[model samples]
Target: MVLIDRIRLCLEKLLEVFTVFLLIALTTIVLAAVGFRLLGASLHWYDEVASIGLGWLTFYGANLAAIKRAHMGFPGLVGSAPVALRASLFVISEIIVIGFFVVIAYYGYLVLDILAWDRLVSLPSISLTVTQSAIPISAVLFILCELLSMPGAWAKMRHGIDSEHEAIEEAIRMAEQDLQESRS
Candidate 1:
């Protein structure tokens, strides 16, 4: 368990760094595109490349979210389950989530073959495969994140802990603290 925690920590840090790099690159590209457009030297590849970058950002951000367990969930529903049923429900939910990503990764890989000869309309030198590789790559990353986080998630579920509720409660407590400080 400690080893898994350490691995998750490393993966989380790596993802954070990569995602920040992607964001900076995307921002630079957009600013350059805009600057060029204003100078009447519009970049033809701007739209396509920016779109691809955004897709990459979303996919990779999703993996980060998966590792952090920050994705949307009906925690109340899950936490409300009877203790006897909670374990089964948790397992079923995990299997469904993981299985869905597996299918996505499989098809994403197959689509790369179909797009092998294709190139971006504005940048013929750049293969469509390169742009589209984010699909399969991020899907695999997400699955890995999901698996790495499962033990912690199982522990939480077994104890009927709802992360969402916990987050809200924490926020409320912080707000109350601030209010008390203001009063003082």
Candidate 2:
């Protein structure tokens, strides 16, 4: 368990760094492209490169969001539910999430297999698989994050405690109280 946690921490840090790098790279490419275009020296490959970078950013960003439990969702219903029911619902929701990612990743692998020989339209040097691989790669990363978080989720569910959600809720409650006090 210690080793698994160490690995998870390492993976999280690595992904965080890579995500930042991708964001920086994407921003640089985009800004440079825009500047070049303004100077009347447009780069033909800008759109293609930008689109691919955006796709990668979306995937990795989403993976990070999941890891952080920052993905948007209406959790009010679950939050209001009875403890046992909430835990059950959480488990069910997790199952659905995991199953969906697994299926998509499997199909993504198939897509990669088919597109292995294909190259990008603008960047002929790069294989389509390389660009399109963001899908399966992100899916796998998400799965790993999910699995790593399972114990915490289960403990929270069983104990009727979730520090992450509770912290947010506490903050909101405090803000509401402050607003009320100020109005009074």
Best by TM-score: 1
Worst 10 residues of 2 by lDDT: 68-77
Scored by Cα lDDT, where does model 1 land?
A: 0.94
The RMSD (Cα, Å) of candidate 1 is 1.9
* Per-candidate local distance difference test: 0.94, 0.85
Q: Residues 1-184, candidate 1, lDDT per residue (tens digit)?
A: 8999999999999999999999999999999999999999999899999999999999999999999999999888989999879899888889999999999999999999999999999999999999999999998999999999999988898999999998899999999999999999
For candidate 1, give the lDDT of residue 34.
93
Best lDDT among the predictions, by candidate number: 1
**Ten consecutive residues with minimal summed lDDT in candidate 1?**
83-92
